[model samples]
Target: MTAAEVDAYLAGLPQDQRDALEDLRKRLKSRLPDHIECLSYAMPGFRQPGPKGKMVVGYAAFARHLGLYPHSGSVIPLIDCAPFKTSKSGVLFTPAHPLPDALLDAILRLRQDEIAAGYGRRG
Candidate 1:
């Protein structure tokens, strides 16, 4: 889905879920004003174009929780995601208690570095 489609997707969600996800999207856009917003793995995310163009990260909201997808193999595992269910695949952030800014910053920075260094390529 394109960025517009992504917006539509969020709009279709419940009020609370839409607000939470849209907040995340706005913050991400402010941090990555130059990057392109795209649907990576069917989720809303940012990407840098070129030969090395790749999705740095993405997010999805489910019936139970919100998920951050770093698109890497090791970054998620390296972080301590206490009180939240986490694994190599992604980190779950519930609406009742969303992820902290520090953890989200760390995740984005790590994924950006991996993309810049050509370390992790999404499948």
Candidate 2:
């Protein structure tokens, strides 16, 4: 999604989902200036390195769940994702069942490490 799409997407969500994602967005932005609001893989995302930046993490709302994509399939294993459903690329949650704070921290830290190791470095 583009910036406008992101706004529209969020705006179109139900109140609870919107509130949950907005809070997630804040937490995503809390770490670095590079984690700016944008789109990644056509979803609501944060571009690290700021404008025209590499995608660090992104999220999207689905009919049944929400997603947190760290842009690295490998980073998924660094955290314990026992209770939630996880794919090779991301973790899935619901508004009634968002990821815990510790899991979010672990995901962010692991993503940073992966980036520093040149996982998602843009040309």
Candidate 3:
């Protein structure tokens, strides 16, 4: 899916959720210059380059909070996600309390390394 799909997803959310996810979308775009922006698993996400490219990250808005999905179960556990609610595959935050840049950077680095090493992908 294209960015327009992502845009539409964001547009349908409440104002707070929209702003929060939009902020994340911008951050992801800035960091992942070589990655393709698309909608995956019905979430706005970035994919690695090429036909075989994997999903690097994804974000979505929920009724109570926003979620940042690394698309890998192991990625979230490897980082310090204090002060935010987290699950095995996603980090949950609110518009008032967004994920920090450093945390996002760490998540990106770890996920990139995992992708490079083929950790979560099947051959």
TM-score of each: 0.89, 0.86, 0.96
Tens digit of per-residue lDDT, candidate 1, span 1-123? 478988888988898888888988988888788888888787898887655577778899898889988888778888887878997878998777878888888888888877777675456
When sorted by TM-score, best at the front, the candidate numbers are 3, 1, 2
Candidate 1: Cα lDDT at 65: 89
What would the C-alpha RMSD of candidate 1 be, to one decimal place?
Answer: 2.3
lDDT of 2 by residue, 89-110 (tens): 8999999888888998888888
- If ranked by lDDT, best first, what sequence of candidates would result? 3, 1, 2
Model 1 clashing residue pairs (backbone): none
lDDT of 3: 0.92
Q: So what's the TM-score on candidate 3?
A: 0.96
Candidate 1: global Cα-lDDT?
A: 0.83
Candidate 2 Cα lDDT to native = 0.82
Q: How many residue pairs clash in each candidate?
A: 0, 2, 0
lDDT pick, better of 2 and 3: 3
4-119, model 3: which lDDT tens digit per residue?
Answer: 89889999999988988888899999999889999999999999999989999999888898999999999999988998989999999999999999999999999999989977
lDDT of each: 0.83, 0.82, 0.92
